[model samples]
Target: MAKHNIYKMSVSEVYPHYITKAEKKGRTKEEVDEIIIWLTGYTQAQLDKELEKKTDFETFFVNAPNMNPARTLIKGVICGIRVEDIEEPIMKEIRYLDKLVDELAKGKSMDKILRK
Candidate 1:
């Protein structure tokens, strides 16, 4: 199968959209960052560095310090597809982040959103 163009797109390219989506609903950038950190185990500084370096989605996830095992628990429909049902590894990881940001924007509390 052909890889989606998004795989090559830099995380920095889509990051602002995530922040805007959250902020439009009164959520903070910190919350979005928290979600990313939880999923990929990137320190705030490391995440920032990746963003500054324009790391593509594939590379960003490939280099994740410690992808949370709990991320498999993130189950739901995002972009009309079930995240857990995605068979492609990189795409699933991308959708997992999307789902978390969606939950935060919809006003789910941090604890529940974090699945704690």
Candidate 2:
């Protein structure tokens, strides 16, 4: 009999990719994704649910302010989310984005980090 490919496995099973070339450090693929959710400021349960559609901050900020994944978690974990309270993180992200704009505007050796 032959073994099954990870890509063919369910989300509960194979994840993050079927190959690894480096030291293979860090947590399980699922855990890594959960942490990414936390770092992006999602609540634990919200992070765990894999059913909801995925979204990014840029789209939420531009088109659907009501559809922010982080906002969902933030409202759940913290006090009621106020426009004033969110101003800082939003500004920070905007500044970070603007820095990328500035760097690219200068035509530097844009690496993978900046590309994202």
Candidate 3:
């Protein structure tokens, strides 16, 4: 059996209210999961932690240790959890910086495009 971030068997047997591009496009949950895994590099637990912090729509520029400032954070309610978006140009720069740390960890990088 393979591991999954959003749909770990331990979490639940069903994902309610979760709407994703994958879902909209009629992609399998596993396929969508792959894209998420590719970007977040989260090993289930870590992903859950980030997901836990999100509870509403909030945008900000984050500059932590070893990070470049100018990233736009777009986090909001998605299937009830807070999902972050960093697709804005400002955030892309931050994503690039984070990616520099480890090319393999780009999956978890914050660089989601804002829907609005």
Candidate 4:
């Protein structure tokens, strides 16, 4: 199988889809933003700026203000792959965010989603 070029994909392009998924499931965009902030430690303002800049995923993650150390505790399957088992660090981080969003859309409590 061919590898995906996720690094070349813009976070801006993907973020709105995440919001839509949450909203369709009766979750708010603010909730989506909150989970993102929790995972990446990016303030709302910084996240907005990155979205406006249309930076690729690689740059967006690389420039994150602070990655929460507790994020390693996030464990689950995403796209049939266990996030904790992902070999690539960047892919693992991206999957961690995906899993958090999945939990949010599934109406998991914010405390639980944040792994409290």
The models' CA-based lDDT, in order, is 0.96, 0.33, 0.32, 0.90
* Residues 24-95, model 2: lDDT tens digits: 532243434432333344454553443233433343223321322432222211223333344454433333
Best by TM-score: 1
Score candidate 2 by TM-score against the native.
0.25
Question: Candidate 2: misplaced stretches above 4 Å?
Answer: 1-87, 112-116
Candidate 4 on 1-116: residue-level lDDT in tens?
54469877999999999999999999999999999898899999999999999988888878889999999999989999999999977788889999999999998999999889
Candidate 1 per-residue lDDT, tens place, 1-116, comes to: 79999999999999999999999999999999999999999999999999999999999999999999988889999999999889999999999999999999999999998889
| Per-residue lDDT of model 3, residues 68-110, tens digit only | 2222243343334333443344334323323322221323322
RMSD of each: 0.6, 16.2, 13.6, 1.6
Off by over 4 Å in 1: none
User: Which wins on TM-score, candidate 3 or candidate 4?
Assistant: 4
Per-prediction TM-score:
0.98, 0.25, 0.31, 0.95
Ranking by TM-score: 1, 4, 3, 2
Model 4 clash pairs are none
User: By the TM-score metric, which is better: model 1 or model 3?
Assistant: 1
Clashing pairs in 3: 38-107, 39-107, 39-108, 40-107, 40-108, 86-111, 86-112, 87-111, 87-112, 87-113
Global CA lDDT computed for model 4: 0.90
Q: lDDT for model 1, on a 0 to 1 scale? A: 0.96
Candidate 2: clashing pairs of residues: none
1 or 4: which has the higher lDDT? 1
